[model samples]
Target: MKRITVAVLLLMSFTTRYGGQQTPSRPTVLEHVTVINAGSAPMSDMTILITGSRIVAVDRADATTIPTGAQIIDGRGKFVIPGLMDMHHHLLNGSFPPRPGGIQANLGRLLAVGVTTVFDPSIGRQDFARLKAAAAPDSSAYARFFGTGPMFTVKGDTFADADSPMPETPAQAEAAVNDLKALGVDAIKIQRDDLSWAIKGSGTLMPLEVLAAVVKQAHTQGLKVYAHAPLLKLAKEALSVGVDGLMHGIVDEPVDAEFLGLMKKNGAVYVPTLALFEDVADVAAFARRQAVNWDRAKLQPPAIYAPFADAAGARQIESFLNNSAFTKERLKVARANVKRVFDAGVPVVLGTDTGFFGVFLGVATQIELELLVEAGLTPAEALRAATINAARMIGKERDLGTIEAGKFADLVILDADPLADIRNVVRIYKVIKGGVQYEPVDPATPR
Candidate 1:
């Protein structure tokens, strides 16, 4: 596939900003529509001049603001926001080799809903390479995908597992770290020792020592470590070693001020992949919805996901959740949990942990954001978690998460102001990825 050179595709008419520094000047002549300046001290009516892909100039939306020799776009009643981002999302289906068109669907849905950037914290190294290739500017089919493969895990450990295809030894772990570095794995993921062995006694699993060594060695190789910690002893150990980030919310045991202070000192980022739990809930709900008079449906198969669905699955699972929820009142617990964590100042980033669970990438992300708000974030704060703050988490602060010039041209145009109502973010009008414009879908069109 042909790649678009930044020299060629990047702004010349109007300065552009996508994961870059210094907002470029808007075009003296305009094309698309009004420009929206986000992250400003006071966001008001600001018009951006667009000459092709570059934004040349920015000025108030007054009659005199229109430049001569510029093609005017109707900006009367629309809003333009910097493209949205998802810090922790699985690549499409999240399995090795992934699935055909799965990444494409995820990206499309993301762009459709104004998500222009995603950081896939967990991915197969092999799969990561494929996704990275597909995300190249020229032939890419989705929003930008930044990924990290298997965590440093030992053979058959139980908390988390490695998925580099072949088993890894201490020596092999060092080589694995080297291989991932050579292949440009974005960051190293670590979880309370790789525990796949306990799950099935798979001999291929790496031991906790090996996993820790992997993290230690990967750090030497200049890779950041992200862990699926649950405040377990191993998690504390991982933290004590100074991981760069912690994956998953502080489940199992609630994090205290002491833990938060430690994390703060370590400069570790926390990605609460809360939607994973909701995914299980959603699946049960989906199943229950499917069983409603499945035999009477008119489709050729009668009902789409019925035969394979366990009719009693929902009730069975609900019984367990009911007990759990009733015990702690899950929502109340989660809310209190978030308040505790946030009040302690643990750096938070948005993540949905899609692909493995029933949660689809793009769809589940929005749900995560909604839940984040429910967990005590103002919509703007939640937006920052998905955008600017997330970028900071991956150490990509100067690159893509926010809107500024010289940044990657990843962006989303929304019809509504998300800061006002996060849910309105779904009302996306257009998406721009690396300077390529993706026109919005007309809902009236048949799927």
Candidate 2:
């Protein structure tokens, strides 16, 4: 594996100019690479020309002309794919009292694992501002961040934050959407499901009329609404009311034809965070059979596992294990729903609900891809879920997603073809964000 050592040069070009005149810097080119463009056939032996932050050209290596002073990365035997997107991520600030240094560490880990973009479905106004600042394009590292600032839900909902709007009427819901629009949120997130399965108490469901108002106002404001509806009934209600996407799989029951029809009618996307449900079951299974071993833990990476390696972690695992039956059933139903959704031609975007209990940040995205494959999507289809489909969900398909000319040069180079095996996505050779190449993080180090 060849490592590209041009970070210093790339950083310098961002600010440096020759003779007091801003001259175009030499383009960086990836030559003779197998491009696995999401939603399209793979193109072999292609040359990708990148200038500044955009891919300027993608052509056959033999037919393309390299610039006079281009920085060429020999991409022989390597596979390049568009950077992965996590549509339903939650930043560290969402944690109770928030974790110190969590934002920087999480961002680094996410980018290290080829996740160049992430959409946080729930964040407070101040936290969203902070995240936006940290993820600015000028920063050398960090995933491109978009978020819904403060979800809309009823009071006493399990997922509700202090700032979350507990709208009682249609006007209040509209006001909440206006407030989020003022906060510059990329979308609206509505929590409508009772989370009693995870939490002890029976959670409150948001009123359908208020939910409808929120969706309508968000759409009127040119923003999409992504509803957190884990049950079949809630999902149907959200779809009927015009929510643009479901933030989780329908876990209560298998989705029927009517639900699929509503999804198609509303042009909605399904984000089955399968890795989340699987993580719960995995933790339960691990607790039932063996003691905690950080290295051997299936879900938690070392850095995430470190904090919960003691007695507390054991208790947490025990609690989940006690509810193993529910978690396992949810995982089963979620997987089935994903396959049905994909087979029905509805767009299925990849998300892992990262930042939740037991879900590691960077590695969780890869797990989601694998789970997508396990749910009956081909490796290529899974790639599309994480790439082009995610972009479409976020309304950034034009600038992000697919490897093509005039798109952001956010890409991942793999030593092995992910099309052959989805796990090969972890065999990252290099990650390029905004045309700047970054070396993958060493797993031996703490995240």
Candidate 3:
């Protein structure tokens, strides 16, 4: 068999030696991998025994002897953790500017990074349902599609990337929510004041009534609502209006004590997409200091990123990054906000806002975990946010997110103990979901 590097694999048309015409199913047993079962009841180690998509048992002492006729993996010093999930992702084909092979390249890169499950808080109506479902279910590689179709933006004033199919009237808004519910979307992404887009350009915000209506109608069908209200006031408003969660910390001012209190009282989960601020600041500084800009030249194709490199998008990026208020110093305040909410024990789910900056999904998920620890989480706590904690937020804690008897067999093989060092969580060797195998590419270390 020809030795393929198995890294930076974006083109899907290529045939692989291991992956071929047939779809791979889940392996029966995984040996040698140190399993860090992220659980609350009783955390222990054992060999995971699987049948179909569910784990049959986890015998602590003897994993090899527990199951026969099972495909056993040679863990060979790898670590095993629950497959990582991302809460805030942009899963759209045309969300960015017109760039050839842009979305395709981004998706491929995401899989390489090890994100097994992703929740695109915002996606276009035309693309979300069709492409999300149209994508094949592989046992491994990339975050599986779990998304809300499009932002419920007001007519005309929507971002160029968004699919603004929102209705203006209360009746129209209610029906729009019903249509999304009928399509069985995971959630609705409520944008800020996009109704005034034509008049105000970018400062446009969604009306309070529209958001309230969407929230009410979507929840009636057992769906959740996520809103993008950057400042404390918007966040508080969303909470007061009974929004399920807040997306990022783009608030115009510092979050006050009263609002923090309300966030705790409401049992609302916060999915702070913090990595963007960090990446932007870090990359900007690097651009100034670096002798050569590699990611722009080699890592990304000019044809792909050209459209997104517009005056408007560039202005937005610069404004967000240039705001000293949202700097590393500000991270202290954000941490205080996180600590305040966390101390109150409000659910702060893990999300990377991947698909930004041409990053692949899988790798971006791990990066999010790394940042979570940097803020305040211990290794185990960080793992929890990505796995068990995320499941709870999605209202799927009863079934998904862990490796146990009767739980789904979605697991990642790591090279070290994430519990001991959360940063080591990226040492992934494979991703197994629902009894299917996504064997990690481990080409022999070059001499």
lDDT of 2 by residue, 123-204 (tens): 7888888878767753346678899988888887756778988899999889888988998899999997776545545677
For candidate 3, write residues 57-85 as lDDT tens digits.
Answer: 66553423533344666665676777676
What TM-score, to 2 decimals, does candidate 1 have?
A: 0.75
Residue by residue across 1-447, what tens digits does model 1's lDDT show?
Answer: 222112212222212222121222332322334444334442345554443343434445543345444434455455666666777777554222234455644554455556667877767667788767766553243666787776555444432445742335667767877888888988877656322211222223335666667778888998888876643455666777677777776644567666777788888877776666443444545333323322222111322233225556544444433433322324344445666766677777888776653445455666677778878887777777787777777677675665555555555666677767877666656565554455544211111
Model 1 stretches astray by more than 4 angstroms: 1-42, 50-58, 62-71, 93-101, 157-162, 165-170, 193-209, 285-332, 442-447
Count steric clashes of candidate 3.
Answer: 25
Per-candidate local distance difference test: 0.56, 0.76, 0.58
Ranking by TM-score: 2, 3, 1
* Native RMSD of candidate 3 (Å): 7.6
* Candidate with the larger lDDT of 1 and 2: 2
Name model 2 segments beyond 4 Å from true: 1-25, 93-101, 138-140, 284-303, 306-312, 317-324, 442-447
- Which candidate do you rate higher for lDDT, 1 or 3? 3
Candidate 2 local distance difference test against the native: 0.76
Residue 171 miss distance in model 2 (angstroms): 1.5
Per lDDT, the best of the predicted structures is 2
Candidate 3 Cα errors over 4 Å, as ranges: 1-27, 39-45, 63-66, 92-109, 135-142, 155-162, 193-202, 250-254, 280-282, 285-329, 358-361, 441-447
